[model samples]
Target: MARSTYVSEFHFSREVRRLSGESPAALRRRIMLERAAWRLQRGEAVATVAADEGWSSAEVFSRAFRRSFGIPPSRVGAEFRLPAPNGLHFHPPHSLWLDGNTASADIPALMIAHDIADTGYLIGRAAELSNTQWRQPLSPNQVVLDWDGPESSVAAVLCGTVWAKEVWLASIEGRDFPSRAATDPASVDARSLAVHHDDIGAHWSAMVATMTADGRLADTVIDALCDPPESFQLYGIVAHVLTYAAHRRELVRALLSRLDVPTRPGDPLDWMRGN
Candidate 1:
């Protein structure tokens, strides 16, 4: 498959500021919980919570709930934890971190919470680089981009890939995943990074130039980018880049967690701030 130009270079220092004070674990939980809540609010089964929240399994989520809230999820009546139609507003303190946002006075729990918080900070920092202007070179771990060479900074490379995907989506005017046609089957075929750099560099540069002309994207454009069309709009493309940054951030967090990397305590609200 050809490489996609979805994201670009990032300066870690600058990018972190834009996403300051938020943790990935918190954000992930928040998005998932809200999704599940919405489903529940609409008379959906509690199992829908796992599906909407992106839990690996209902058992896993139930365990986590019991550990965090001191009550079996089954016993918690729907009335005590009603889902907001729009979304769940994570309360303060609990909203700060995701690893363990509880206020229980357990020392061991606090230590675990600290660990989750620390790791979350690192993940958030890495994401910030992609979201901001960091001129650092790309690392192999970063997602590959069709436009840039393998030597590009890790942050930039990931951003470029996200940007390209958005461009592809916009070019076809598609919704995101789960939508019947969110992805363009034809566009999924990405070239090897080397082949992509050699073949698509010029096209990538042209797109960047167009984006440069419009700096500070407008909202409509961002919406278009996150959800692309067959044609291009400068603002829309930029929005796609930002949205990709956010999405990639989530992917990175999940990867890190699976790899057993340490994380900081965080709340769902922290990660939801950007979108």
Candidate 2:
């Protein structure tokens, strides 16, 4: 290493210790043991793992594994990771998961947030249009959802987009469906949608974040709100909402653009940049 890196052996050793807080040999041994623990959890034979990980014997591997993991190899569970100062974790299939890395945001939460913000922006822009333009049908007898009736106008499409969130949130919150001007596509204005969007967006974001953090996304809920009742997964409901909401936003954008109302293409990348 010293010759390859064009440095003295002593200097190389010192820098390795300073940077990694472990001598080179110690790092290699710890990583090898961590890998062995992972394979053992996958039901690899102890003797095979011992040899594959370069341990001299099964007994030697067992002692080392016990010392590092505080559990016998046979007792290994779901957790294969061991603590390390460098925050490096061996992810399965030869990858590294860096602990404490915050550069990446929770993706599903981000999609939900972007949808909320972009929908709100479009609604606000739609509000500036004349009532005639807002209600003027862009596609006659058009329907986005069979039950929601015709989302053929700016007011209808925009309001329907917001209402999708309102309706699902009601189910998640175990409450009755919301009604009034905000729920009425033809009647709902930008101000109504804006206020309701914030309210629903907060609850929606919180619910998803909580459920995700608690590892409850797979947990099922009895959605009595459905006719005759049905069950839904927490994550499924979120994906459903975001999927259709993306469509509604684009529909609104097209409707608004037809009226010469100013708007963007509603690209999430551009939306992210603006914010």
Candidate 3:
């Protein structure tokens, strides 16, 4: 028989504080997961989430769920099998959704538990994916969204800022101007996706190192952080990455939506509102 550990009450409250520091993009991702948890709590079947949530297909939800939670929906419930010891789960009122544990019979507790687990899983996954040296570039799906022109350098700058803003919005909460400019607009090819994803990690690492080593915010926030702004802890770096990833993912959806490609519903304000 599998032994399940009850998440202690003290741990729950403490974890919430850690989660509270997430940037705007992370918060929105959490809100979306909360809705997913609520839907599951209401007994909605995963197969029906597509029709119910306006997604083009259940597969999209599954991908988002995995990306958000680190585990597939089929493996989410209690009594569901777990891989080794690192699977994810969700409990309740947690903002994010996903968790891992032995079988569970408590629906509300499970919902919140899973949310916490999923949040941690997503953060850890990001770190792991970023640290690897795999040569796989960004997904080809993003190629069509590349904008080009003589002013394309300026546009790339803006896009890089958008990427950095997502990092700040999701984790640091304070702005950091860490970004890289793409010179050749034509270089923003299908490979750009890979480059962009790598840049997200590299840029954020640079921001963290710069802030810690020199106590300087990125150039993007030089004006705002001129007064020696408060320093964010290491966890803050993780939060920024999470928020950044969520925002970029949504941006991908938005661009695709404009092109008439199906997209997942996104709520930037949920993060912007600081919820």
Top model number, lDDT: 2
Candidate 2 residue-wise lDDT, 1-275, digit = tens: 88999999989888988897887777778778878888888889999999988988999999999998899899987888787888766778777776775767667977988998888889889889887887898888878889888888988887788788778777777778677466576676677778887887788888888988889889777966579999988789888889888988888888888899878777888877987
For candidate 1, lDDT tens digit of each residue in 1-275?
01143333334323433464323345445445544544544565666667556778888877766664456555554433323323335442234223443554444223323323333344344443322223343234444344433423433433344345445443433445322122222222222222333333334344444444555223233333344443545455545544554444454445445445444424334533532
> Which candidate order results from sorting by TM-score in descending order?
2, 3, 1
TM-score of each: 0.23, 0.60, 0.27
Candidate 3 or 1, higher lDDT:
3
Cα error, candidate 2, residue 222 (Å): 3.0
RMSD of each: 21.4, 9.6, 20.2
Q: Global CA lDDT of candidate 2, please?
A: 0.82
lDDT per model, in order? 0.42, 0.82, 0.42
* TM-score result, candidate 3: 0.27
